[model samples]
Target: MTYSGDVTPGGAPAVRELSGLTVSKLSVGPMDNNAYLLTCRSTGDQVLIDAANEAPRLLELIGGDGLDAVITTHRHMDHWVALEEVVAKTGARALVHADDAEGLPIPAETLTEGDTVPVGDCALEVIHLRGHTPGSIALLYRDPAGTPHLFTGDSLFPGGVGNTDKDPERFAALIDDVERKLFGRLPDDTWFYPGHGKDSTLGAERPALPQWRARGW
Candidate 1:
């Protein structure tokens, strides 16, 4: 089936396709945060990104498919409330950043910048993007056809950016990182899947960087 739209309750965005890897978006929590499901076509292996608050719904989505791992973008409760339950239901290993790995309900395999995580025949590179949280990360992956994909949690958004009000220095750093690391290097065609709002391309967001910067983060 072709993947599109929010598949979970509360208008969460999700996209799945049998052709390549499938990506499902789940809306969780009072804030309506987005969680993702990435499935490998070659091996039917899957990885869950940010469990949110809908454990039962996430489990149903994983039905029959072998869940290999769960990745948390950061330590925020809105992003990880259901992480333990999903791990228990799918028997999948958890992957998180070392900075925020502690205090999680489940054991997790810590990931750092420059690390590559494999699922089936595909691999996702971990990019440390602090600001929204000390351990926030963006997962970058390339499809078989060389299409670049970036799963940016609260770190980035279309037209807008992640909330960094928790710390001024951290927020400033995050803005700088987004400008240099993400917007500067990545191709315009790169697909940006954010933690909230609709999806957009790097090309689309490039023009808006100045505005975001002008706002002073």
Candidate 2:
């Protein structure tokens, strides 16, 4: 039942406990995209975020039991490159924002802001973040102990917000959502898992909010 500290040979990172849920992260593809697997221990229901790359490794993680669904954070090619293969192998439902749904190789059910994605007994509240992609969304889960776990797909990261163009409007919108919907509302202790790289806490990234805004991405 214990997970390794580093990514296992199968490419799955150490399993971490977030409240009642078990989270397994994987780094795949040439882009090093991050894929997350959330399994509800109580119900054995599991969902995956970003079927990026390495179908064989991902399929190994899903195991014979398969997955309940796969949620695509955005329509970027790097994030969903393995979508077709994973879905074909597991028969897991695919979910993406309506705006970005067309970008996928196959049609995916749309999930918008305010919607709740059920993973067994746990629920992930969706938050639509703009700029990086119009349909880019983040998932928020508040543990019983009151800690917030955020899955911000390419929208927010450790150093700063997701890459935005010189377009002031786009940068402004992205920072606005990150500051208000995310930093403004969540506690400093909130844990944010992004589409790539190591996980970060709101507390770790809070003080730099002004800098991120002033510099403009």
Question: Whose lDDT is greatest here?
Answer: 2
Tens-place lDDT per residue, model 1, 197-217, is: 567889988988888777867
Task: Write down the lDDT that model 2 would get.
Answer: 0.88
Write the residue-wise lDDT of candidate 2 on 4-91 in tens digits: 3244334547688866898888888687788889999788899999998888888888888669899999999999989999999899
RMSD of 2: 2.1
Best by TM-score: 2
**After superposing candidate 1, which stretches have Cα over 4 Å from the reference?**
1-8, 11-13
Per-residue lDDT, model 1, residue 4, is: 41
Candidates' lDDT values, in order?
0.81, 0.88
Worst 10 residues of 1 by lDDT: 1-10
Lowest lDDT sum, 10 consecutive residues, model 2, at 3-12
Candidate 2, position 205, lDDT: 94
